[model samples]
Target: MRILEGAGTYVATTSNHWEEHLEVPDLSCGTYSLPAGGTDPQSPHTEDEIYLVTHGRATLWTPSGSAPMGPGDVAFVPAGEEHRFIDIVEDFAVVVVFGPAEYSRAESDTD
Candidate 1:
């Protein structure tokens, strides 16, 4: 088993919405945080993902629609779907999980 601490420090140093922490052959996990007015500058991934909100509030938008999100909310996004958080009312933070191992952003960008 592995243990990770210092979430606040981790969040403080993160420069993007997502900061990967664990990567195994079949899955990956990361901390995602965005301050108010911040935007996610990433494209849709090739792997399915789950987001567990831990702090703040925002609206999650996908190709289908948008919905309000806050603490304790869990969101799921299928592979190749367009999505992002908009109108961040506070510093939003979440734990994100990706299945089927390491989702390469470079590869996704090329596709």
Candidate 2:
């Protein structure tokens, strides 16, 4: 078995956020952290995504609505729903799981 040190390997940027690949099995699982005012590109997902906030606060913006998310908050984004994260605080960290997890994610512009 292997251990992942989340604090050391976390990527940071001024614009888009960073994601470190911990493990992507049939179900994708990893820890994601978003810096203050960071925003992500909009895209349609092939699998459902569950975000469990473990730190700070954030707001998930979708075509449907904007909702506040903080520590202990959980958000489930259904497949095919175009969505993105916004209004991130400096310590926003969450564990994300993408179910079915068959789809591959590339660092391409999902505009």
Candidate 3:
């Protein structure tokens, strides 16, 4: 099995807003963060995604509806669904997991 030490520290120090920490054929994991009141710039992913909030507060919005979020909150978005985090109430951070690994579908699409 693989091990990652200081994963949180690395994510906090990363240059980008998101950091991918692990990946394999079936799944991937990463950390995503945003400042208070920041806009989410992501489009829908090609693979299903799950988010486990570790810090701050926000709202998860989708075509179906929306729900308030905060530390320890969890959310899931299916592939190709329109969704985003909005009304961020504080500096937010979440651990994200993707099925079939993120971008794996994008590669197949280009073929």
Candidate 4:
């Protein structure tokens, strides 16, 4: 077993947008952050994803429409679906989980 010890602190202090903490064959866990007015540069992923918002407020935009999210809210995005965070009203911090590991399905996607 492994531990991320102080994941929130690391994520909050990191300079990068995504700070990955743990990974195995089927799952990967990390933290995703965006400051108010920051751009969401992420695109669709090869694996399914879930985001647990631990701080701040934002609008989650998908091809279908948009929804507001904030502290304690959770989100799930199926693989290959287009989605992004927009209109960030406060600093956002989220715990991200990916199934089958992030980017792990990219190679198989060709088939």
For model 2, the superposed segments whose C-alpha errors exceed 4 Å read: 1-12, 17-25, 102-111
C-alpha lDDT of all candidate models, in order: 0.77, 0.71, 0.82, 0.84
Q: Which stretches of candidate 3 lie over 4 Å from their true place?
A: 6-16, 107-110
Candidate with maximal TM-score: 4
Q: Write the per-residue lDDT of candidate 4 for residues 1-111, one digit (tens) a residue.
A: 677764543244323388889888999998888888778889999999998888888999999989999988999999999999999888888888999899888976558
Clash count, one per candidate = 0, 0, 0, 0
The runs of at least 3 residues in candidate 4 whose Cα sits more than 4 Å from the true structure, single-residue gaps closed, are: 8-16, 108-111
Off by over 4 Å in 1: 7-17, 104-111
lDDT of 1 by residue, 10-54 (tens): 254333556777888788888888887777776788888988888
lDDT of 4 at 107: 78
Worst 10-residue lDDT window, candidate 4 = 7-16
Q: Quote the lDDT for 66 in model 3.
A: 98
**Each model's TM-score, in the order given?**
0.83, 0.72, 0.86, 0.87
Across residues 35-100, which tens digit of lDDT does each residue of candidate 3 receive? Answer: 786888789999999998888888999999999988888889999999988997777888889998
Output the lDDT of residue 94, model 1: 81
Q: What TM value does model 4 have?
A: 0.87
Q: Which run of 10 residues does model 3 get worst, by summed lDDT? A: 7-16
Per-residue CA lDDT of model 2 for 78-98, tens digit only, reads 888888778876557777777
Q: Report the CA-based lDDT of candidate 1 relative to the real structure.
A: 0.77
